[model samples]
Target: MTKKILGVFVIAFFMAAFVLFAEDAPLAPSPDAKGDNFLLAADFRNAFAEYRKLLLENVNSPLSEYYFAKCVSVMGSSGGAINPEQLLDIEKINPKNAILAANLLRLKTGSFLKQGRVADAERVADEMGFVKDWLIIGPFDNATKAGYKKVFPPETEFHTDKTYEGKNGKNTWRQLSVRPPFGTIYFSNLFRADSYVAAYAAVFIRAEKEQPVAFRTCSSGPLKIWLNDRLIAGIEAYRECDFDQDCTAGRLKPGWNKLLVKICQKDGEWEAALRITAPDGGRVEGIVLQNNIDIIKKEILPAYIPDDSDTQIDADSGAVGYFSKLIENNPDDHFALAGLAFMYDFKKILDENDKTVSNNARKALEKNPGNDFYRYLAGTCDEDRNKRLEALLQLSGKNPPSAMALFKLSELYSSTGGGNSGRRRAVSANEAEDITKTFSVPMPFREEEFLNAALKQNPDFVQASLALVGIYNRRGTPWSLEAEKISKRLLTLAPENPVIVRLTYDDDLHTTAENAGHYAKLLAVDYTDGNARNYCIYYLKQAGRKDEVLKEYRAFLQLNPFASSIYQRMADYYEGCDEYEESIACLNKALETNPEDIAAFEELGNYYLILKDIPKAQENWEKALAVKPNLPDITEHLEALKPKEKKFWEGIAANPVVYAAEALADTEVPLHASAVNCLKNEIIKINPNGTSSTFSQQVVKVFDEKASMNINTYP
Candidate 1:
């Protein structure tokens, strides 16, 4: 009975196993189901939808929330706008996901800022604690009334309306507002200079009942302010954003106080605005309405004038013509003549053949010998033409009258060996140092002191200014402090002079606009001045202005039409700009100018190679080699082109039968035998040299003993 039970169990197990093996088994299909095939197929909509569904259905999945946020951030709002509530929901789902939250906030804040809804944007920023950290205000409305009411109240009364005179005079009456706490005020006007004028426009702040009010006003040009007819702050020269002169007078009384602003734009455009923030850090407002009308008429009206002279100075042709006319009218005007002479000198330096107007400057001076200006002009011409000693002799007379002439003489002397060997050697050792000391000593010395005597008589001398700055720079002093002081003075005198502009802006000591202005100041000058122009172009390129670089390079080439390497440089520039065909054309032009140019051949060959024209590459390489054969690198490259052969062994057996037959064959055979016999004998002769020899056996002794030493040596 037990045996019968065991048999029955075995039969049942086999039947169950058979059924299980026949049926299909269950497997995980989730990987394929959730795969990125939809993304690969570029069906972003479907992929996004599926991802969202997965996140909702599998909230516990670690990667679900992350991917869902990524998709939402990338897709953004397709229709009206993304609902803030939905975003808030995502944030709550994964609060630790900072990047996603930050991106979403940025987009929302950017949209708000663009619409000028600063209040709403600030509210959101407050919630995110980003109010103080991330904000860029300004390009604000700068009208005078806008600044006043924003800071004070309409009921506030002024002490005097008759501060100055005119239609929009300083005596004009207006209401002022109480001051706001803890905020900065930005004031501006349209005067040629930046000085303040009491007139139609001013700031009036309403004071709190007992709170002390403080403020600051910094100007780049000139500015002034008053509180209830009381002078508070004043500045002569403008310094934008400076903290020194731009401060409030003191605390103010509460209830109806007036503030007046007298601003001017002497040289350029002007406008002003104020930023008022309460001490409690709650209230913040910018540019409010006011009653001052003349501020707009006088200080601000000139800014709007269509015929303002300052604007004309910035216009390209106008600026060029302005200098040109100055030179034309006052042919012997030292400054004007010097300016014009330098302009032409620049061109001459760039292109020696361009004598144009510059060549006549010296003649103008000769026409007016009493005009001390001609001396510098003649000296400059001589110096530019490489007559250094002659220039020094003409300018450095015993009765030197101008600091510029003396400075030029000093430069020439220092540059041209300073007289004989001993003196020259001594000067060379401390030449830069001596020049600095001599130039920095200021003006007014004995007749024997050439530079000082000349400069003392002519303090406004441009040459003296240039000399002072140059000398200070070469002295190797710490931080170039002396040079900076002199340069600033020079800039104030001639703000638009190219040389002064370059010196002020190009120093290692200055890396910001506050330190100086943009390098554009340099470019604004004439490019005919070779040293200044080249330096300008170099700085522009360093500043990453590639378009300007190409333009300047083109101008340089125009000035130097016959310079040989310029064509190649232009070609390189074209190639950098991805103008391959232009590069090829330039190279062709270069070859036309100089057919024997090996560099052109090499460059052209490279161009063709890039185009994959191997035959053309070979052609140029061959041409280059033909001109200068045995050129080391080219010879090796040519040799590399030769065909190579596959190596093989000569005497190895090919088949086992051949080897076995050779082992059974005889030792000796005749010279001329039947073809079959020769084959057999040749195999047998292999053993005749040595039957007992293995492949590694010493064959030299066997050959000497049996192979016959008398056999012919030559094959």
Candidate 2:
């Protein structure tokens, strides 16, 4: 009784303290506050004081120690207080709360070396279970928490539900039907069942409640969620556990939202659950419906129980012998037959050189006539041999072919069949009509009838919408208008999607500039899309904003080091602006990656030529010509340099006569006929005075006669 009374008093004291503190405390400034603001906001000093009091009241409380350590570390001048040794001592107690333990350990180990406690810090850091080799520092208060925020943005919410299947004719998991309208929740593989799958769905509220909204989603295993008819998220089976806690935080407009969740069990039993919470303190525990609790039971289907024998074959190998034996015992087993057929087809594809496997698959089809599975196997064999016609003939009889069959037909028609002239026009016209009606669709819709059928089944299919965009973009009358309409609708569905951004901003710079000018006139406009910004820059450049282009390019380069083309473009702009040295520098860097880049070399050569660096120009031109001797302007450049080379030789040749004359005077062996004849021939060849060649030849004859006499005297 006394212990109970003490516990009650402690609870009352804690409640009163919380109330008093809440009343007195100022609202927290932004979590991003730094320096003095950091010290003042998040109430570091008050947190410290309260933690100190808590420590005094309950000396053994791990929570108090953890918070106290955090407060002390955060409140310290620059580098955190409570060094590695001190934190290590606290972590030794091993607090049960994982989050608190993680936070305390993060703060201590993050700066252990910078605090001049290297050896001790390393030991403590290892003890605290820091796994990653590299330490990343940030401006935020807590790096891990800041990282979480970076990955999962704040002010987001999620909703999801759990599902289960019956095992041995007993309900495995009770269906919780109450689902919340808005909230945040952390979902995990709680039951550890093979078929266990969970989802966290959140709708991000945009500023204008009426504006159309978008959502982002993250899922575990094979999961998919759709907003309206557009798929927002999907994960394939056997993928890594993506810790996407805040995946869905995009702008969501106020309206009716529909979400469909499907999870299939490849192996073992299926079990799952969800937790729903809201950013605004609204909470829904488990899956519960406020109205008509019994109605949900009726709405929900009985849990799906997959037959154990219906096992999938390995993509790499055939089904195991045991499964094959099962098929042998039960010859009419569709699952085993399909599995074996798929395995045979896969192995045949792997060994395409072997024609025997395809023959075997054909035999399987003959034995199991009228079997869709065998027909599919035959089609697969035909597809491997590039015989699409045969595959199509095999699959054509079935009304509403399986997804796999349809996929194959789509590939064949898109790539090869449509290339035939007669078939091309028919397919193009059909595609055009389907696109005209749907305003969107996936690619390779194959037959127009197929697309029409798809639209009939799901009127708002986004693949249909996209396909319409492509068709109109390619062939519609008034192409731009149709494309723009589809792009606008796609933007409403996936505003932040890069493809949509590229599509909507597809027009030339002039159009974008005109749009920007019009948008500027509108009141309270927010035209801050990144694609729009890029388009604006493009238009501004067209409007002769050379300086702005340089500035933006530099800023862009700083952010994106791999933007080599941007650097090259910026260099061209600099050259245009008469900044030759800067241009050369930029071109040189580009050449580092693409050493044989003729364009860059040519540009650099031109820059050098402009600066009157003839030698540098010659060097760069030589480099350019070496890479591509037959480059368009290079032949002309080489021809132009021929005279320069001739001029250089002429200068050297001018003094050659003087050397020859001196050699004649010095030698005992006379510079007789040969020397005189060589000199006269050179005079004729040079024709320095532009004299007639006949006059030059006469002069050469006179010299030759004189040389003959001189030689006679020497003899």
Candidate 3:
């Protein structure tokens, strides 16, 4: 009884936090604090009602608009389409409300995606720069409230497939790519079976150089955030999930920095929202989201980067075996079958002749005769879209209807079939109990009369094929495999169609680096087009094609030379290729475009360093440090270059952990070069066993004094 009352008091305190704004803050809380309280409590339904009143009271209130839009977003409903400008421009990220900046990004991106404006959606996603892609896993025990503080294995290190002690017997990390109408992770979806639990979400954001970045995070329960395994935020208080509720300044190192978030579930809602922005709260450009920590952790990725196919095979190995074993025990395991099929499909081994996928699906269908889901998987076994469509059509009279099947069937009809069935769209899963609940006419469709009429007469009907293509575009998700299956046919039919080219790019499993050719096709469709411009430049750069980079650089210049990160990247590329002069020219252009380009300043210093122009290199390094202070590498380089800086007194022997990424980064600056310039001898010592013993760094160093560090082994 005492604990429950204490919980209520804590929640009330969190709700009151909304009213505690800085003095002279322009915007205040709602006229009545009820809505604010409800919002802080994660009570979106009541919050929605309250915000509506607030909005009506002051339509011009950006605060009201923000809260109202946030309520709609949290509630998983599209109240109506409001202007993106209202979401972006009105809610400025400033002293009073720094977190609103990330909120603006999420809401803006979600708004564009919801409207089915894919090109606009893609642009917003790329440009707005807050991470929405995350791999989340959990339901670790929190029943006794200890879970909130418990350090799980994921906190120490994370593997996507590693199973740890979850609330259940077993749980592995699953990709929870949060998208539209979901600015926050609604953990209720992931941890449905378990309550009083905790979950962890992780993603890596890469920075070209050490730079300052601001972060805003909030959760419905106790929350802890770690950046590169350093605890940045830890809020033990369970509060309403509101963005910017806990805003803090953070720094990103010169590589991928892991951002791991843990949110505990105490009661009503389990949710988390986080965003990383520029220190000034604008979109932090040049930052990219990494889906995995392979390169960062330096565990799996070796000296050379593996092709995508090899990587996918490595990823699918665990799932394939786990699900295969489950199916052996219970052949009717729909989930196991689904998991197995997924792995097989990803592995590109799902063939009708492939023993496991086909035979297991066939056996499941034979036993549970005419089951919608089993039948669907059976059709999938054909491994052909046309045949799959035929199979879905045949499922019209299946014994037990599934809402998922019904949705797919409706989509199939929306493309190939005609639904005179007047089926109100299957909106909810419960409606599967009675298909008639959705359908005004008969449950089973007359395929000859109502379905595939276009394809029956002319199989190559372009419009029909295009409609089929539209069904796979998921909300907030950039890629969809279902769309990719039919992409080839559409591209062949209308190779020049801009939509087809763009959609194909979205679904293609191939990296943008491999699909750099899409740039020309998209540009040829409309040279004035800017949507594919960024991606095209990025693709060419990633592919390391110098000629293509120059070509795209020219094309991008024509589109918008002022907004050029392309040239800065090109500078990096040129330096890599030893084209120092060309890199110098690119850096100059980059500096011209973005005067505050710290990367350009840093790289120019690097180029000058190679050219042996000490004065020029030192000058540029100073400028770089001036732009973004507290960058240890540049500061170290500067300190080393300066005559008065710390000098090695000889006999400086030290041990350094050799990361796979560094040992193999560059042949020019190998281990000996570091040793020659040694603050310490970074020896790669091989033990008597003929292998180097792994040594983890135990010394601590903080470089607050002009980002300078002195690691004295004998200090």
Candidate 4:
């Protein structure tokens, strides 16, 4: 309740701060204006004081009452709760009220929907011809980013017994009533991670007779719609969501017509909107929205099936639920059995490793053996990569070919090492991240062939388009020009897609300040994206605002407190500026966040060493080694500092040999234009018989102010 009140106060504050009035009004701020200021300043008591004065003076004033109610709503008081209807009635008394019509209508409709008054919501929705009710499900596992192209079960059939492997696991259709006026199905809370996600919103409308209607929908993410199991209209772009954004004319059957929509979100808001209206413009009347899948199945779905033909559908258009039902009634129905087996793509029921399931499917295939698609499903469902590859090969040979199979074939080729593999997971010391490996072109012919074929088969296939863009992007030639065109094309398909954003920019972070906005968008979608944060930091630094860089770092930390690696990097930044105290504090915090952070321990040791705190240095290095043994540099450094007869640093005081500051290595650069003069390699054999030829040199002397050196032969 407190949080809700706070949110309301926050919103009201902004609204009040910008509230405008008539030009002829007095110059000084009005009571509503003063109240708004207090709300904005977070002085709730003062804000309420202003509201009370306004309500007392302007008795029965709609604007005054609205402001008072707004303040009360956020104060956690139920005594004078907001009455949207009363407020609306008050506004009606004076046609020229201070409150905007849009704002009033929104509040009224929202309140109605929040209270489960769908009829009220529908009444409000009638103004905009928006659909008020829908059966919605998902935040499905779209981590693979196949939401747009891959056909999930909902596309084939809709049944209560059916469930999809959704984002929350095993999701079935549930009711969603939109907030009134806008009809926005706000699903901002559905996404829990920063990954590509997909959802389904369905409405089964019963028409009096066959009729034509326009389907209207909008979203801030990639969206697609289907009517009665056929693809209709879609826009796979992340644009501002608004009513009547995309429209398509769809035919409704006499019985029940299923309007299925698939929407994909990469980040930020995971939401969608849907509405159906008459072809001419007004609301489609006399249509009942079927809320129950079972009822729809009984009274509607069966009617859509052809009366002339039996239960036969094209191989590609097979419905899993219908086939399962047919097979249940007749166990020996080989065709139905095969059709059911072909639906191995569903992760809910078809477990690839289940022997019983596989045997049953194989038997069904044997009853009607040599079915290429059945074989494809068999191998495609298996965990073995070789099997899937062989299955994909079979599909690739088919007449006209399969776009999906060709796409998968290209993927296999890329992973096995040719062309640009979209992205790979690179695990850091603290977390794993999707690292886009933007490789250069000169892709293998086979990989290129498969991708081009896939695109040829289905030009709008998103995954294939992305792959081809990746390929064209790598080539430093006219192909890059082509890549730019295709990249723009792909952006239209999925503009907010992190992958698309990354590919579009392609490591050109030095363009202008405008480039930072792209990373800002990336961070908005994924706050934990270290790469985006770094780009932001880089741009901030280039702008000569070191403080802003630190602010950016803190902003990311606020979103993800367990980002220990960020703390370590912060430590490095401070240490570079010779702020030893700040560096130590950051390192300590990193250790606190991740106890076994070996890098932080090693860094703490390095800081201690520079500060001439011998014991402190020894302790931290020992701690680092304890976390993970066999760390050579830490082990050697720790032993050398352990109560030596003569300290090891006594030597560095004399010779002052500097080593790598980061990870230890024996790697060296060749001599460039050198001005510094020094050093020679000397071989010291402990054994009298060990000659220079027989012994390996443990330490070689080198010379350079930056990096270089030579050999000193003690002949």
**Where is model 2 more than 4 Å wrong at Cα?**
1-411, 417-446, 478-487, 498-537, 551-564, 625-715
Query: Stretches of candidate 1 above 4 Å error?
Result: 1-405, 416-449, 507-521, 524-564, 573-582, 625-715
Q: What is the lDDT of candidate 4?
A: 0.57
lDDT of 4 by residue, 406-482 (tens): 77667776776323455433224232111112211122245677788877865655566777876776776888888
| Root-mean-square deviation per candidate | 43.1, 30.4, 25.1, 27.6
Give the per-residue lDDT of model 1 (tens digit) for 458-516. Answer: 55444455666665576557537877877777776566565676677645665533222
If both were scored by lDDT, which would come out higher, candidate 1 or candidate 4?
4
TM-score winner between candidates 2 and 3: 2
lDDT of 3 by residue, 1-715 (tens): 9999999999988767755643234432224357534432323456567655654454433243234444444343211212344435444433233333344555665555433344564565455454567777777889877987788888877667578767754567766533422345566644433378888887777678877776756667777877776777687765466545555567777766678888887778777767676654556767777665444347432322211111111111223455667878987775566546534543333322345665566665555453444566666465454555555545533333232233345455444423554333332444433445544324434322222443443344444445545544532245356567667777776565566667666426776655777665666555645666556767877776768767766655433344346677677777779899999998887665344467778888878877767799889989877656778878866765533311221221222222222233533433333323331233324232223323212111211222123333334
Q: Poorest 10 consecutive residues of model 3 by lDDT?
A: 307-316
The prediction achieving the highest TM-score against the true structure is 4
Return the top candidate by lDDT.
4
| 1-715: candidate 2 lDDT, tens digit per residue | 9999999999999999999998677534312223222222223344345444443443333233333443454444111222334434555766544333434554564445333343454464344322111100111111222221222211121212322222111112222212211111112111122233232222211122422222222222344444332444443442222211112211222332333333323333222212122211122122222122233224322321211222222111112233357567986554444445444333222222345445545655555454544555566565363443454434432343333344345435545554644254334667555544443333343444444443443333344445556656766579868778877877775444445556776355536457544323221122223344465556667767666556556544433333456667878777778788999999887665345567778877767766757578778888888755677676544444333222322232222233244444554555556646555444424333333344333333333456555533442
Residue 328, candidate 4: Cα error in Å is 11
TM-score of 4: 0.40
What TM-score would every model get versus the actual structure?
0.31, 0.34, 0.31, 0.40
RMSD in angstroms between candidate 4 and the native structure over all alpha carbons: 27.6
Task: Give lDDT: candidate 2, residue 55.
Answer: 35
Cα lDDT for residue 383, candidate 1: 28
